[model samples]
Target: MPLQKSPTGTWLPARVPQSTITLAILLVLCSMVQSTTGGYDGSMLNGLNILPPYTDYFNLNAATTGLNTASVFIGGFFGPMAAGVMADKFGRRIAIFWGCIITIVGVILQTAAQNIAMFVVARVFIGFGTAVDGIAAGVYLSETFPSRWRAWGVGLFNDFYYVGALIAAGITLGTGKWQSTWAWRAPSLFQGIFSIMCIMILPFVPESPRWLIHEGYYEEARTVVAQTNADGNPSDPVVLTVYKEILDTLEWEKKEGRTMSPKEIIKTPVARKRLLIGMSAGPFSCVVGNIIASYYLTYELDTAGVTDSTDQLKANVVLNVWCLGCALAGTHLVANWGRKGTALLSQTLLVICLFIIGGLSKKYADNPNAASNSLIYGNVAVMFLFQGFYSIAWTPLLYLYPPEVMNYSIRANGLAFSQFMLNALAVLLVFVEPIGIVNIGWKMYMVNASWDIIIIVLIAVYWVETKGRTLEEIDAIFEGQKHSTVPDVEAVRKGEATVNLAELEKEVAATALIVEK
Candidate 1:
């Protein structure tokens, strides 16, 4: 049967039930906590670094400060090693809950730290927990949302990171005048709130239907598919189609003896390509010069002649707000422009902005007194533009693109490995950025801009568009054969279409035999 279009010409039914919308909102809110907590941790550290009390209390120099900032990634580096196993073995929701619990413990330790050693240890835990939570949440969001809503659902997940960052920046800015350790400790203590929110919301949300099918809970998976996609109408054509597709795909995967092992990722040419593209989001996001602004904004601002602490804090607040707006806009862009197009546009603009900023900074930043006010201001303006463009594609795509491209068998593990690479590289760069800023000054931006030019080419060559396709349907792109056995929903609804599961299974077996022969 041919695929039929909705009368309303939208991806979903025009009049979706209110209950479905409510469920989607809840799932988005719950999944958003991982990024929100991360944003808060990063912005809090950035804000605290600017405060005299935080620097004085820790006795931080460039090296120690880099160690302190990089410690979270160090912890994150180890977390994904176990994140994949926990998410796959236990369940996505369980992994998220436990990860949040671990983060809360880290938050408590960080709040009461009397020495730098205690603080660093605490950050490591926070990093580990957040990493685990992040991978699970990314997979959960990608798996649970309907195909029509998946891009926005997963895109907004990381956009909320700015929400957490904005809050942390505001709190730290407000508390900057305090002459005590609480100025820094207060922000540290607040990092757990988002995790706690995630824990609270998880009970009200459903698990991924795909995960349910993978674990042999067919009825439960079907029920979830109906609840989320068809508003509890089990007989609805959309629900039936999705449910059947998931079943057939999983059945085929099993007959082919696929496993979730890492080795399976590199077992074939297509699999290797999928792994490379899925992992690309990690390092591409980290290497784009955002690290300098994310963790070392104060240092960057000082070099640009914004020497006052108050001014710097205010700039941090504005930058987070700006990034949030741009990231939200990017969610819409991905739907209209497609993934590859939006990324290409964003990367091109980033290169241009970074190049100009480098030139302006090199000319004026070294001699702020001798520089004209407009020249100094131009450098700052370009910096904001660079971040804004960065937010447009990289921020939303950071979490959205990776899981969409990977099949269920390796999605959880692939996400973990991608995150591990991100953390590993972040550990080095976050540590090295401050030193680079102190030693090489503005040339760092130039170097980073040059690197981004190459990234644009890689993205053009490697990334595939995943717009407007169901998770099971995406496998067709990778394997050059449609995995879904479901027919048209409209035909199914009219009782004009039927699927023969036994025949489908026989066909799959025959295909496998041909491959072996």
Candidate 2:
């Protein structure tokens, strides 16, 4: 459905320094840390998969592996909510900076871990720190950028996430030493360093303008928002318009009811549902896509004749390279088509692809190879297709949507709940995946594919259009059709709910102290 603008007229631009490149650089640098942290986890997933094979190295069994894997996710589950709350209680910069400290400590503990028990404990800290960074990245990027580039900025900030996975794959391949501890530990340590560096460097960048505004630091907020290079000062016209809107939104919000607060997130039905949908959508992507990929790494490698550490590394390199292609395709399609349409269609196509890949995998397993390696090659091709298509459509954007779905009140809480569900789903799937490969064989792929089909149905039925929708529009949708489809008493009476967060940001930032006469 096409959107109708409320009195706010959808998202309005907040002018920033002309040096958008500097802002872009800070955003990208932040993403590198995002990618690196994820890369560490991806490496662990791959390395741990192979660990079960070499009992002598880790002395790990299925039960231990389950505990270890689940441990990290369990940690990740709570960390986002905690970060979100702390972020609000304090500020974005402190929340993120402290997350780096936690991350480094977690990495050190994990690196020195002498047993699976120690490893599991350390993993929790890692999960906690990582979640803080990830959620903080989402909140930070959204609040930091102007509206015109919001989607692309989010996407671009997140793209390095996939790129991080590729880098981790390459690191694994380069080592050709998955049998050793460094195969996993080294990546974690390296990423920890990167995370810490990001925190240290963040001091040089400005704080979130909206956040500054929210605290009623109007002068500082204005100076930052209207900052420039030629004279490095705020221009008069820019200052006036920005100041006006800030007052406008605050007045409109008061005219409506109460000032927005996080506690009110679940107070109403629409707010409650928005929180649920927002949180679930992100981690849901992982439950179906990422966890499944991590689960089946070994089985796929074996099918491709990548049995040993060396060969397995080679297979990953191939998958990594192919995955980049798929990421590109997925991104291109989604950009033009819109998220819901693309997500539904991709999920539809994924079901079909999974059937083909699974069926081909079964045949390849039985025959191993035939007609000059045609069957295995075909299987590999399908696997690539599965990863590529899903990577593009399902990968980055799934992470994007949930956070976008909710407004400020319940954003963190919603994300926290969803990550918990997602982590739990991942744990079950991860455990089931290996067992399925050994016991159920190619039938498991059919199961995953079928499950996705069911999820797509859910998507079609309940999924709302989020692309191009402002945060308020999303909140309206989340508030549900009952609250939103017909205008509210206020919206009807006033002809719209007029809130310009852009202007609210100005007074909130309190730029008077920062701006020069």
Candidate 3:
């Protein structure tokens, strides 16, 4: 069966159904729930520190405040490992359900906390619970979206993370009205609203068709693939073709006896390459210094003499909106530049921006007079630009790349491990930022700037392009087969090449024969 040529004379897959797009939106929203809250929760202390009324209520200084923020990443360090098991064993939907429940509990704890200890503990709970939502949503989107739209869909999913950040910033500005604990407590309670929305929607969405096929639920998987087809016709060639591909890919994995354990992932060649590529993104993203920068934005700006609390919160709103816009632009950019290309370009820009920010900050550290005004303004402009570059490369691809690279056998586990590595580094950076600020001041920017230089080199060498390919097709790229970096949607739609199961099965068998010889 072949794709029918439309009136426009362009070959394309059947129009993906509105239902599928709706599902994708829900999944993206699911991702945003935790991220928005995580953004709001993680940075709440930062906003509070600058607001004297709230700071007086909590009696938080730089050291104790850093500890509270560090506690979230501490739980985040372990959350993904636990969530991975749940996702692989129970299903993506169930993992997300449990994650939301735990997050709501964590939110409740934070909202009602009588002391700093209770609030710190609550951060850990939010970290642990929300980590699963982030990991599961990425894996779910990767496994389900059609090949042509996969990168764009995943980009949308990741882009919403800034939506969460924007929301958090808005909440900060809104809540700044009250001089009481409600200023912070209201936002802490607000995080639950998104979680509750997710919990309500989870029951309605279909499970990942790939997971169903992997689990031998062929009938269910077929139905899902059919239902999500643009035309919503199960008999559509595109639907049958995708269903067959899923079946064949699962059979091939079974024949190979591939291990799914995170512990085993590092030992397999293709799997190890995937893991490294995915895992490196976490540290590289951290080394770029966005997480630390976001958490301490208020402090950094305040130190620069943006002393008014409302004014500091307003600055964050503007910065987050700028990042959100960049993320929107990146979704379209990936089609032309490819994942690795976009990342290289983004990282190179980040390195230069960081140098400007660090150099200018260091140049003006001892002097706050009018003579240093240009340096201060330059530092601020570069800092905003820093998020712009990161949004282009890291923001959209952060969720897309890891899952796209991993084989289905270890997809959940691999992503979980990636998140684990991310939070582990985050734990250190989150803890280190305040201490570094107190002791070394603006020089901390120079340390990250140097780290970004190394990240640029690493990405140039190791990263592979997964754009314009299906999940199963990406396997061959890592297996040392020659895969095109060229975008292939036009070819697939024109029937020049189809990602059919029969073709992929034959390819797998041929590879096995070569290995045996």
Best by lDDT: 1
Check candidate 3 and list the clashing pairs.
15-230, 16-230, 17-230
Error of 3 at 340 (Å): 0.7
TM-score result, candidate 2: 0.81
lDDT of 1: 0.84
Task: State the lDDT of candidate 2 residue by residue for 1-517, as single tens digits.
Answer: 1211111111222322245456556665764565457655665456545643323446766666666766777677778668777666566666677777787888899877778778788888888887777677667666555443455666555555556666666765654455576756665566576677677556445555555655665555555545421112354443334343333333333444533455656777766777765665765476454455554476665655446766565666567667666666665665566767877877777788889877777776676645236666677677767776777766656556666776655565565566667766665666666666767777877887777877787778876666655343454464443222222222322335444445544543453333211
Which order, best to worst by TM-score? 1, 3, 2
lDDT of 2 at 403: 65
Q: Which regions of candidate 1 fall more than 4 Å away from where they truly are?
A: 1-18, 488-517
Q: How far is candidate 2 from the true structure (C-alpha RMSD, Å)?
A: 7.9
Q: Which structure among the candidates has the greatest TM-score?
A: 1
Q: Higher-lDDT candidate among 1 and 3?
A: 1
Looking at model 2, which ten-residue stretch has the lowest summed lDDT? 1-10
In angstroms, how far off is 108's CA in candidate 1? 0.7
What would the C-alpha RMSD of candidate 3 be, to one decimal place?
6.4
Tens digit per residue, CA lDDT, model 1, 1-517? 1221112211112122226677788889988976799999889998999999999998999999998899999889999998988888878888998899999999999999998899889999999999999999999999989877888999999999999999999999999999999999899888899999998877667777877777765666666777677766656667767777777777778777888776777777877888899889988999988999999998888778788899999999999999999999998999777999999999999999888988888887667679988887888898998888999998889888889898888888888889999999999999999999888888998999999999999999978998877777778888887666567444564577875656654543444343233
Ranking by lDDT: 1, 3, 2
Q: How displaced is residue 290 in candidate 3, in Å?
A: 1.2
